[model samples]
Target: MKLVLTQFKIELLRIFRNPYYVFWSLAMPIVFYFIFTRVISTGATDAVAWNKHYLMSMTSFSVMGSAIMTLGIRLVQERSQGWSTFMRITPLPGAIFFLGKMFGQMIMHLSSIICIFLAGYLISGVTMPVHLWIYCGLWILIASLPFLAVGTLVGCMKRVDTASGVSNALYLVMAILGGMWMPIDILPKLMQAIGKWLPSYRFGNGAWELVQGNPPKWEDILVLAGYFIVFMLISLYTRRRQEAI
Candidate 1:
């Protein structure tokens, strides 16, 4: 237990030390929220609804980005630099290491959710009931598990540069296609169909519905769960293959 706690602390410190966590996870989303809500569509019809909707969008966006880009790239670096091998040889139990890292990243995701929610409240004057706020935040954090699995899969890459590029591209493509950047309704009909199936869109859709006093659809929950199972299976396969080399 003590070793797990220590490893958790180390993971938190390591994550905070990465400038990308601050810039990409924290700062960029807030800036995008400000620009989209304040600058681009200051005159949006039903400004309150737009603000709330976009708040959920950006919060989901930040958490997803951190899960894929931050976690994935870091894992690749550790493996390439032989840190993963060193850890494997340590006395620390594998489950303990996994728990610590996963819990630490959960903290990171929670922080991003809080910061973006704060920006929505302070900067955009978006208001919601306390329960609704808590519900939406919790939903985003929970729905982000599949993306973390994607990160683990990306971690299987042997090269940091390759992982970095792949993760970045994956992050951007998912964000854009999933309707995190803009409303899926405005996109072409074909694109809208595709976005609805994407885990990213399903991720934000649940939170968006929550803020609007609707429960997330069963389809959304099922889709996310399916992706989580598939990604974790693939990640496990890749990791075992790497170990055999």
Candidate 2:
């Protein structure tokens, strides 16, 4: 238990010291929210409604960005530094090591969510039932699992530079297609069709539904679960291969 806690703290320290992670995970999303919600108004009938919608979208975006991009890059760097190899030979269990990483990522994810939510409430004047806020936040965290899994897979398989390039490309493509940056309805018909199947779209959709006082669609939940399973399988396979080598 003490070792796990120590590993978790070390991971947290590493993340906090990385200016790139701090800026992208904590600052960028909040900035985007202000630009979209305040500078460029949607002019909807209910200001709160527009803010609420963007809140969910931005939250989804932030969660995906941190879970996939940051985590993937960090994992690749650790591997390149031979940290993974060292850990493998240590007395520490693999589960505990990964769990510590997950805990650190969870902290990043929750912090991103909170910052965006605060921006929505304070700057954009978003108002909702307290329970709705809690529900939406929980859904955002839950929906991030697939992306986290994908990050782990990418980290396990790619070198640091390659992982960074791939993760960034995936992040931008998913965000654009998933209606995180803009609404899917405005996109070309083909793109909208493609967006419907991406995990990022499903994630944002679930959060949006929750904000609208509706239950999340089971299809979205199931799709994300499927993605998580597939990514986990690939990650495990990659790890096993690396161990054998």
Candidate 3:
């Protein structure tokens, strides 16, 4: 337990030391929240609704960025530097190392969520019951599981450069296609259909539903769980292959 805690602390320290991670996971989303909800859509009648909606969307975006892009690239870099191999040979338990990375990523994920929510409240005048706010945050965190699994899979498969490229591609594509940049109602019919099938869409949709006083559809939860399982299997396979080599 102590070793795992120590490793978790080290992992968090490493993440905080990285300027790119700090900026993307914390600063960038807040900036976007202000730009979109504050500057661009000033004096809107549905300010509260729009603020809450965009808050959820931006939280999803930031969580995806951290879970997939940041975590994936860092894992690839570690593997490329032979750090993964060194860890395998060390007395550190594999579970501890894995937990350390996961916990570190979750910390970043939570930070992003809080920052976006804060921007929504302070800048956009978003107001909600305290319990609703807590529930919405929890839902967003739950929705991040599949993306985190995907990140682990990406981390296990690609070289650093390839991982970076793939992560960026996935991040942008998912964000747009999933309607994070705009509402699905405003998108083309075909695009809306495609977005409905995406994990990102399901994630944001679930959070949006919760914020709008509706229960999240079971279908969305099932789809995310399915994706999570598939990605976990792929990650396990890749790890086994690496171990064999």
For model 3, the superposed segments whose C-alpha errors exceed 4 Å read 42-45
Q: Runs in model 2 with CA error above 4 Å?
A: 43-45
All predictions: root-mean-square deviation over Cα?
1.0, 1.3, 1.6
lDDT of 3 by residue, 1-245 (tens): 78988999998999878899768876777788889886786455777788888888888988988999888988898889988889989999889999999998888778778877887888878888888888888888878989999998889855888998988999999999998877777888998999888999999989899899997899889988998999899889888897796
Q: How well does candidate 2 score on lDDT at residue 119?
A: 82
Q: Per-residue lDDT tens digits of candidate 1, residues 1-245?
A: 78878999999998888887899998999999999998886466888999999999999999999888888888888878988889999888888887877888999999999999998999989999999999999999999999999999998887888998999898988888899999888889998888889999999999999989999999999999999999999999988887896
- Candidate 3 TM-score, C-alpha based: 0.95
Best by TM-score: 1
Backbone collision count in every prediction?
Answer: 0, 0, 0
Order the numbered candidates by lDDT, best leading.
1, 2, 3
lDDT of 1: 0.91
TM-score of each: 0.97, 0.96, 0.95
Worst 10 residues of 3 by lDDT: 38-47
Per-residue lDDT, model 2, residue 243, is 75
Give the higher-TM-score candidate: 1 or 2.
1
Q: What is the lDDT of residue 119 in candidate 3?
A: 76
Regions more than 4 Å wrong, model 1: none
